[model samples]
Target chain A: MSELVPNKSIYEFYRLVEEHHILLAFQGMMTTDILTMMGKNLKEQAEDHIFHRRIFSVMVELVQNINLHSADKAYSESDKKMVGKGIIVLSTSADGKIFTVASGNLIRKSEIESLRQKIDHINRLSEEQLRDYYLEQLRAPEDQDSSGLIGVARRAKNPLAYDFIHVDEEHAFFLLTVPIHQQNSDK
Target chain B: MENFSIKGSNYIPTVHFDAKSGVLEISGESYHEYTVEFFQPIIQWLREYLATPGREIVFNFKMVYFNTSTSRRFLEIFDMLEDYQRSKKGKVTINWYYQNNDFDMLESGQDFAEDVNLPFNFYTF
Candidate 1:
């Protein structure tokens, strides 16, 4: 991968995506229009429109979260100067069955605690529990940004895999990954 | 009441609902920046329809894709029908259609059916 793209920025990441069979990659400045475009692309590429739709929707929901609610905002065009800036990538496994969706973004030092708790809560849920969580969030009023992460877990047919890397300046780079969990099993 | 339609985008689901026919169809992909914003009016319309529904409603979802936020909203529609089915019993039927080749769709439809306990008929193309 490194020999293919010597540069470590965009070239390296995109190369990694290709090698790993990453489906969709969302890095740098995530906007509504671009998110919408990504959704359409997923629909076109997916075997199951519903499955594709959910992943696309989750991407839009979560990435926009970084755009809107991130405590750190980077004001730049080339790279993310925003505090809550990050990237999301999607790719299929070698088998072409298990789809992996991964998102990485920066978060405030203070916000990390809450985000961690939320992720933990989601991870703890069974499918039924996640459904309950989703229902609980839905029954309440709208405009709540908190449920977006939980919604991803709830909607996932397979267990959501995640990790966090703490960068400098009281900012943590969080990675949330989900696998479709089938080896072309048709489900 | 008010009729609206938003077609499929790369990351958002396709929306096609008919107010007059009381037949709602949501299919294709879904991943949008503004979920609640996009779905708000539709939810409201369902609320309105429940108040004075038509003779029969056949809600069909050929959704092969939907995220958690959208999933929650979909549940709302189902719950509405189940509740509506109580007083307005047997007036609504939700066809949770999926491609025969896809196991995810079948399981997903079954999951929703189990939650609502409604006979979500699974159809194959």
Candidate 2:
């Protein structure tokens, strides 16, 4: 809607989000780089036992999201963190109740609807159903192996909620708001 | 006392464990494809070391960053060290070091200390 030029406004807004709320922000040129920045961020999140298992599984989902949806035409999901190409943010909400992680990159207008449908479908399943499906996928071999969004759904199961913001249909930003597991809140 | 090294990929960290020096370091950037596969050998080594007995093992993690999969392996390694320390076969001293302002790394070391009941001297420069 605004100037195509990199908005100082966008960077400033990103700064505001990171300074005030983020537990971690995988900002500045994070496209489909599974090896570098985003992977680093996921690894940090998975440092804990809970994350080592559940959250990591969810991260697989996010990775898939990058793999499948990243609009960049030149790179695969498992490549470099292209400048001005990808943005992934991992953070927690103010109440400490939600850990929100999201990513964005260029994509085609035609593909957006299908991806939206996929995310919506994944989000609708019950916990039991989701778990069973996760197991099914787990047993199955890696067909696509992007960020395991389905895996994230069942494994990480956003504690708060998962949201998304579309920078137009051509570029959509996905936000996953997961709550801190209340059961393991002591740590 | 076997020497092993695994290359680090964009998605995983390389693990080089040296039994001769009794110096086992999980250093460098660690973001692995599969947590289980990458860490399985390190876990196996620690277990085998515990059984065989040897000099006190030293752990140095000058890691820039590690993913969740590697963290699990780190935990397992810490557990093995604790077991070694308690058995008294050899001493295990962990110098968990980090840069001056790497809060995540510092806190992570603290978290490990709490979990393993090991006295992790958290140092930052």
- State the DockQ of every prediction: 0.32, 0.06
Share of native C-alpha contacts between chains A and B (below 8 angstroms) recovered by candidate 2: 0.06
Query: Which ten contiguous residues of candidate 1 chain A have the minimum total lDDT?
Result: A76-85
Model 2: residue A162 alpha-carbon error in angstroms: 2.3
lDDT of all the models against the reference?
0.68, 0.57
| Residue B118 shift from truth in candidate 2, angstroms | 2.1
RMSD of each: 5.6, 10.2
Candidate with best DockQ: 1
* lDDT tens per residue, model 1, A1-187: 4565456677876778679987777676666556666766886887755556556655766676667665556665432334345787888778776677777777666777776777777787787777567657766665554567765665555556666677888877777786655433433
Per residue, candidate 2 scores C-alpha lDDT tens digits across A1-187 of: 7757578878987789767686555533333354355455655655454343334444444554454455654433444323244555556666655555555556666755666676677778886666455434443444342125554554454432544565774655554455445334233
lDDT for position A44 in model 2: 66
In lDDT terms, which candidate is top?
A: 1
Scored against the true structure, residue B35 in model 1 reaches a CA lDDT of 62
Q: What's the TM-score of chain B for every model shown?
A: 0.85, 0.84
